[model samples]
Structures are given as structure tokens and as C-alpha cells.
Target: MNYNTTEAFAQELDQKDPLKEFRNEFLFPKNQDGKPQLYLCGNSLGLQPQQTANYIQKELQDWANYGVNGHTEAEHAWMPYHEFLSESMAKIVGAKPHEVIVMNTLTVNLHLMMVSFYEPKGKRNKIIIEADAFPSDKYAVESQLKFHNIDPAEGLLLWKPRPGEYTCRTEDLEQLLETHKDEVALVMIGSTNYYTGQAFNLKAITKLGHKHGAKVGFDLAHGAGNIQPDLHNTNADFAVWCTYKYLNSGPGSLGGCFVHERHANSPKLKRFVGWWGHDKSTRFNMRKDFKPMPGAEGWQLSNPPILSMAAIRASLDVFERAGFDNLRQKSKQLTGYLAYLVEELNNPNIRIITPSHPDERGCQLSFQIKGANKSVFDALSKANVVADWREPDVIRIAPTPLYNSYTDVYTFIQRLKQVLA
Candidate 1:
């Protein structure tokens, strides 16, 4: 498809889009004049599904009518609520149903999974993470090391980008594993880096980590709804992600975790236990021994917040209806269009940090605008062209296929070009 820079071209593309109807499924943001604002920040927060309000309302109504009995009598049954979300989320992340569960926030889930998987011993106590990992992840790993009485400055190894390079190379990771052979206990990486939007090769990383006798985990916060990561196929020890971004479950919604089925029944798996993780059969009885449920459920520390889980259920239904494969197919085209527009700018000041190859990235494109400051971002925001500005000079834009259209990308580029002028 030849890229076009006109509104007519964008409209024509929309007319031919198979997923065009999905745009109506969401509630688009509006400007003061009541026109829908151009939303291109799905990488940070996705628009709400029209069904979301009704789903949440149902739970609220049930709670009002049934009181404590809502646990059993609610329409969706609050007692086993998170289970309803697990199967679909598992499908999205490419994990077995039992291997996944909706739980706490992203960073919290990462810490919990690390508790069970990051078992450091003797000389094999070092943990490897990306140099540019999301701030929360860095903090989580550092705190985990501190909890184990290890110095993070020495125990945490950072897989940095080569000097002047924006993305981390797999060969560097392989070399790090080889150099620190038998000394590293775990490798935790962001599947799609937040700053660069570079999607790592999960299968390769997991294979190399396991070969080195180390456990591997991934933070799929940016990758979950943007890319199809087959966690089971990757043979990753575990993975975690949030629902508030591309999943569009609402702000600060519950997150999810995945533990490969191979460890589903591992007796030696060290986890922090809670009643919700105990066998459901004896849960209400309150007298049975704690028998951890197999798979990801075994890691739950408490019953999930039902209100948040309801929102997740609402969003996952959208994914199920849209189908992840179809969304991904359109995503590549939408983001490719955005990249094409950026390249067409022909500005010496702008440099895209995201990988040029479609397979190596998601919907996000991180770019550095030369001679541009926070005021440039302020100008874009004032124009209602919603893109994010990370620290320093990078501006990240994500054109989500679920609700965003080609015209959104076209409009954003036009605004950017004007701002630059």
C-alpha cells in the first residue's frame, strides 16, 4: 500500500478497514466543542469499551441487591469472578488457562512471581535486567534483592544498550549469560521495552537463560495487547502485565500473571500463600489444610478486587470479539503508516528509536526530536493530538487498531509537522 498524506486517503483506508466497526465499540474522548478528540495514546491508556460501564454497573447493582450474598447470588458470581477473566486473558498471552490468573498491579505481580522464581543460592544469586527497564520494574528488582540481603549495586546486572544504540542486542544478552555462566539465578526483561518500543525475542532469551540454569521472566506491560507473545511456546518461567494500557480496562486496573504449566504442580515452588489460593472446595469450610491450586492461581495472595476484575472482564470480552490476531494484523499496518509518515517528514532533528522492522516492535514508535523540548509536547497536547513525552527528548505515539483509525495517524503527523515549523 502506498502511503498517502491526505485526509481523503485516510478516510478511504478507513472505508476499506475490516476492523472499522470496532471504533464505535469504544467511547471516544471529546473536545470542549463536543467533537471526538484524536486519541493516539493507547500505549499509555486505552479508551473505555462502551460495554465496560454496563458490566461494572451490573456488579454494583448486584452488590446493592444481594449484600454479602452477592458472592454466590450475583449474576457473574463474585466468588469465582477472576476465573471468568483468566481463560480469555490466557488466550491473549498465549498461555494455558490454568497457567494464567488476574491479580494485583503489574509491579506487584512481578515481585510476587520473583518470590517464587528468583531463588538465588550460593554463588548463583545475580539477577539480570534491561538497563532501560520501566522504573517500577527496576525498583521491584532492587527491593527484591534488598529483601534477600544482597546489594543491588552488585547483585543486579544490567543488560545495557551498546553505546549510542537505542536497542539491546540479543548477542549482548547471550554474551552476558556466557560471561556470567552459572552465577546468574534469573533473567527478567520487559518483553517490549517502554522507552524504545523494541520487542525482545522471548523464545531466544528464555532458551539461553534456561541453558545457563537460570529462570526467565518477562514484563509484558507494553506487549500484552499490542503483540501476541506465546508464553507457553517461549517456555518462559513466568510473565506479568497490566490491563490499563492497551487492554483498556480503565486506569490502574488489575494486572495478570502467567506461570508455565510445567511448574503448575511443582511441590517445591516457594510462594506466599493466601486463602484464595487454597483449594476452592474447602475454601468456605475454613478447616481444611492449605492446598495451593495448580498453576497461576497458586500464587494469589488474596481474593482479587471484584470491581477491578469486572472491568477486566469487560475489556477481555472486547479482545475476544475483535480477536487478537486480527488486531495484531491491523496494528502492524497502522504503526507502519505512522512510521512512514514520520520518515516522510524528512527532518534531520527527528530519529526513531523503535526498531524499523515490524516484527521487532508493537504499535508504539519512540522518537527523539532534535531541538525540541517539553514545550513541543505541550503544544501537541494543546492541539489535542495525544502522544506521550518521556524524559529528555523522546515522544511515544501508539495508534491502536481497536479504536484508532488511519486518519488519527494522518492528523497527528500534520500537527507534528506544524509544531516543528
Candidate 2:
């Protein structure tokens, strides 16, 4: 695990990487000189897979040739297009195939899950979330509270870090639940926080929430294709994620939803009914009442968009071919090398806020840059380092396992060092 700053060492690592060829599978942004930039912004928006166009073109051709008849006549069959993605999506998130479905976008799916799981009877009406949850999640949870006529300030419980640190502790959530066990109705959290890149222990959180009589759900926006969250084993009531980030399914592609097998047939739980959620056999029978289809598919609000799904299909194909386990192996080493280079800098102004342990983070490394470091970040951008800048003083870099190479990581560190100098 020894890491060196030398380009040859990085080239050697890249040469040995089983997943290195995937770098060629993506279309990277170009620098003015027409070479690919050192892209580390996969945490924000992933580079498009090369096959995406072909996938979409196939669908477009089918539509042009057959129009409405393409629904059942196309090779992929538009009527059941979403089915093609379910199994692969399930594998990426570590869930049973029946428990996962490609459906609405992330926040939209979050709202749907809350409708079925965020039930408030009397005193048990509060929702607990990490203090640093993505802004969209915070908004969704707060709106869900308001929709239920509960005051958000009173109905929401924050599982915050003990002042100085950035990540939330599971014990802290347990303490909050203990203090208000009767009041908590739901536990909604982002499995890996967006800003800090700190991944949560989902199984622990789910168990605690269930023990305290609350339904648990995780927003896997930052965890989905980057880390194996094992939603089925975690026994969460529901989970949701977008395919755009690590899944590389293109901008604002369809999100995925997971409903635990336990809730698959829970007739007692009320849900907003839709035709697409009706049993397929009876779906076309016009007069039949809403008989919810048994698993996560029962949550679908509409027939999926096939073009967007083409992109998801293309990306999931890459995940399937590269293999999730292998991707995780490279991811650990890649991010570790980035961490090593940061520490080797030994600069007082630079610090990594993400948990040093691989289990506590994914591909992202959020740099906490101090005074006068904003210019360094700007320099990194101008030099085509392709990382993202968060407000105040953080520059987030993600060396994705599927496409980034050891060489990219090495050159990024070199560029950063030059900027700092």
C-alpha cells in the first residue's frame, strides 16, 4: 500500500489496474490543447459513457420506425423497459431484485417514500436526520412535516456532530431516539453526506430506528454506485438514489427506489395510488381498482421514460461488466492515494475532513483549504484539474473507480502542489 509521488509509480499502478480500461469508455472534457482534462468531479456529474449515444440511438430508431407499435415491438420492449434495469441496479446497491425499481428522480422518490413510511399517529411524529444532509433532503423532510401539519422545528430532530467534527455519530442518533423514542416516527438520512463525504453505518442506523419504533430510509445519492450499501441486509423500510453520480447515467436520469421485502405486501400502509403501480395483468383493464403490485414496482407513478432509461442501461452495463466488488477494491486504493498525497503535503492550511477509513467514505475526498487557498483551487481549475468548489473553503475531488486512473490521481496531486507553491 505504499504510495509515491512519482509519475512512474502511478503509471505502474495504472498499468496493473484491472479497471483501468474503463477510462477509455468515457468522454472526458477537453482542455484548450485538445487533451482530456484530469477529471475528478464524478462526485458531482459523471462523464458520459461512450455507448450512451448508441443506446439512445437504438431507441430513437425504433420510435421512428414504429411509433406507438414500438411499445411492444422494440427489441427492449418499451412497455417493460424499466425491467431491464432493475436487476443490475439491484446488484449495484446490494439489494434483492424484487426490492429495487428504477422510478422517479431522487427527491421525487423521497416524497413518495415519505408518503408511505412517514406515518404520524399521535406523539410519534418527529423525523430524525443528520445535520449535514443534502439541502434537497432537508427540504423534502421539512415539507413532509409541514404537509402532515406538524411544525418542522418541533417535528424534526437533528443528529448532529458534537461541535468540532463534521460527521454524525450513530450513538448520537441513538441518544436522540432514546430521549424522544415516542415522538420519532421516521429516521431519514443521507447514507454518505454530500459535503463531508462521510458515509454512515446504515445497518446500525436502521436497527436503531426500528428498535425505537421509527421507519428508516436512506438517501443514497452519494452512496449508490460508489459504495455497496446493502439495503436488503440493512433492513431499511425504504431507500432512494439518483443514477447520475457514480452510476454515470447522465444528467438528471431516473432515480432508483428500494422497498424492503417486509413492506412489499404491507396492505395496512397507505400509498398514493397510480396506474403504473397496478398489477401488470390488470393494468390495462380500465375499470379495475388500484391493486398495488407487490414490491418496489408498486411505487412507480408512471411508465418510465425510455430515452433516459437508455442512458441508465448503458451505465449499468458498465457496472455489471467491471463488477461492483472489483470497483470497490480500486476505489479504496485510489482515494487512499489521494489522502496519502494530501497528508504528505504537511501543510498547516490543508486538511482532509472526510473520515480516513475506507468504510467511512467513498470515492470523494473533501479538502478543507484554509486562508488564501481559494486561489489554489482556481489554479487547479485553470490547469484543467476538473474538481469542484463548494462554498466557503472546500474543494471536493472524486477519483472514480470505474474511469479514473492512478496516473490521473498522481497528476492531480502534482498540479495541486504546484498551485499551492
Candidate 3:
């Protein structure tokens, strides 16, 4: 598709967008001038869905009317509330209902997954991760090494990109594994890199890890709701992601976990046990031994936070209506347009670090502006373009297909050109 620089061309595309109606469903932040700010920060935090307040209010009303009885009698039934999100959440990440669980925060779920999947034996005690993985993931892996009494310097292997390159190559990873041999215990990676917006090939990584007799898992903090990792078909041992980003749940909402069906009932897979994960039939009984529930449900440590789950339910409903496949299709086109416009700027100082191919990224385009400072980002903010800026020089803009129009992309580029000029 040829992209035009004209704002009229953008309006034409917006008029034809099938998902255009979704923009109305979100509540955007307004600039001081009283117009909606151009929000291109879905990779950081998605705009609130218009229905989120209603969803939370419903639960609040139920709590007030039913008191403690809301646990069983509310319309959504607090006791089984988390169960309501299973199907739609599963679809978003490309997993089966049973394999997905809405529980805990991103790092908490990472720790939980590591508890079960990061077992190290004999000489196979090292872990492999992306060199520039999200800090939390790196910290979590390092902490895991310490918990197991292994020195992180020796146990944590970094799969770094070549010195001058910006993205880690799969072949380099293969060679790293070959060098490490069977000494590596687990392979954990961010499905979509946060800084560079590079989406890794999950199936290939899983197969490579498994071939080395290691467990493979992904941190989908930037992948969920943006790029489909196909968790089930990727044959990953486990994956974890938060809902607050592209999932559009409120800030710090509950995260999601996906455990492949193969481990659904594996007795040997050790995990931290809790009452919520016990078999439902006897869960209320005080005396029964803990019988773990089948699948990802077995990993829940406690009953979910109703308000947070309510927000998630609200977002998932929107995703359900929009359909993940359709959203993904629009996302590719939407982000592709942003890339095209960025290239049209013809600014040698601005270099896109994100993968050029749409398949290798989500909506985010990370631009490394040579010798740029926060002032450049400040200019964008002053112009009412809400984007993300990492330390050093990268300015990250994400033209989300859900709420962002083609016009938003055009307008942002126009403002960007002014700043550069």
C-alpha cells in the first residue's frame, strides 16, 4: 500500500478503517488546549476503555448490595470471577482456556513460572536470557540464580547481539547454546523486546531450547495483545504477561500466565501451592489434602482481585468483539503506515532500531535520534504527542490500531518534522 504524506490521505484511510469505531470506546487524555492528546503510548500504557468504569461500578454495586454474599450471589459472582476471563484472554495470547490464568503481576508470575520451570540439575545450572531484556526480567533471573545458590556471573548467560548490530540473531543464540552445551537449564526471553520492539520467533526458540534439554519460556510484557505469540502452538513451557499495556486494563492490573497443556497435570512439576489452586470440589472443605486443579488454574496462589479482574474482563470483552485476528491485521497495516511515514521524514539523525518487517514487531517504532536529549521528547510532549522515551536517545511511538487513527500517525509525523526542523 502506497502511503501519502497528505492529511487528507490519512482521513481517507481512517474513513475506511473497519476498526475505526473502537476509537470511540476509549477515553483519551486531553491536552491543555482541551483537545485529545495524540496518544501513541499503548506499548507503555493503553488508554482506558470507556466501559472500564461501568465494569468496576457493577462490581462495586454488587459489593454494596450483597455484602459478603457477593462472593456467590453477585451477577459476576466474586467466587468464580477470574474464570469469566479465561476464554477471551486465551484468544488474545493464542492459547487454550485451561492453559491461561489471570493471576498475579508480571514479575510475580515470572517468579512463579520460574519456580516450576527453572529447575537446575548437576552441571546444567545456567540460564540464558537476552542481553538487553527488560530490567525486571534480568533482575528476576539473577534473583533466581541467587535463590538456587548459584552465582549469577556464572549462571546467567546473555544472548547479546553482535557488537555493532541492534538485534540478537537466532543463529548467534544457536551458537551460544552450542558453546554452552547441556550446561544451560532454562531459556527465558521477552517475546517482544521492550526497547527495540523486536518480536522473537517463539516456536523456533522453544524448539531450540527443547533440543538442548532445557525448558523454554517467554516474558510477554510487550507481546500480549500487541503481537500473538501463539503460546500453545509455540510449545513453550510457560509464558507470562501483564494486562496494563496493550491489553488496556487499568494500571497494575493482574497479569496472565500460560502453561502448555503437556504440564497441565504433571505431578512432578513442582510449584508453590495455595488454596485457590486446590481442586474446586473440595476447595471449601477445611480438611482435604491439596489436590491441584488441572492446567494453568493450578498455578493460582490466591483468589483474584475482583476490581482488577473487572477491568481485565472489560478490556477482554472489547478484544472479543474486535476479534484478535482482525485487530492483528489492522495492527500490521497501522504500524506499517507509521514506519512508512517515519521513513518519509528523511532525517539521517533518526534511525529506527525496530525490525523493518512488520512480522518482527508490534505497533512500536523505536527511533534513535543521534545526539538527542530529553528536550526532543519534551518537544513531542509539548506538541501533545504522548509517546515513550527510553534513556539516551530512543523515542518510541506506537500507533495502536485500537484507538489511534491513521490521522494520528500523520499528525505526529508532521509535528515531528517541525521539531526536527
lDDT per prediction?
Answer: 0.92, 0.93, 0.94
Clashes in each model (backbone N, CA, C under 3 Å)? Answer: 0, 0, 0
lDDT of 3 at 272: 93
Could you tell me every candidate's TM-score relative to the true structure?
0.98, 0.98, 0.99
* Candidate 3 residue spans exceeding 4 A from truth: none
Instruction: Name the lDDT value of residue 234 in candidate 1.
Output: 99
Model 1, 215-319: lDDT tens digits are 999999999999999999999999999999999999999999999999998999888888999988888789888898888998888887888988889999989
Ranking by lDDT: 3, 2, 1
Return the lDDT, model 1, position 345. Answer: 89
**Which tens-of-lDDT digit does each residue in 255-322 have in candidate 2?**
99999998999999888878999999999997998999999999988988999999999999999999
TM-score of 2: 0.98
| Model 1 alpha-carbon miss at residue 248, Å | 0.5
Candidate 2, residue 243: CA error in Å? 0.6
C-alpha lDDT of candidate 2 relative to the true structure: 0.93
- State the lDDT at 93 in candidate 1: 95
Please identify model 2 stretches exceeding 4 Å from their true place. none
Clashes in model 1: which pairs?
A: none
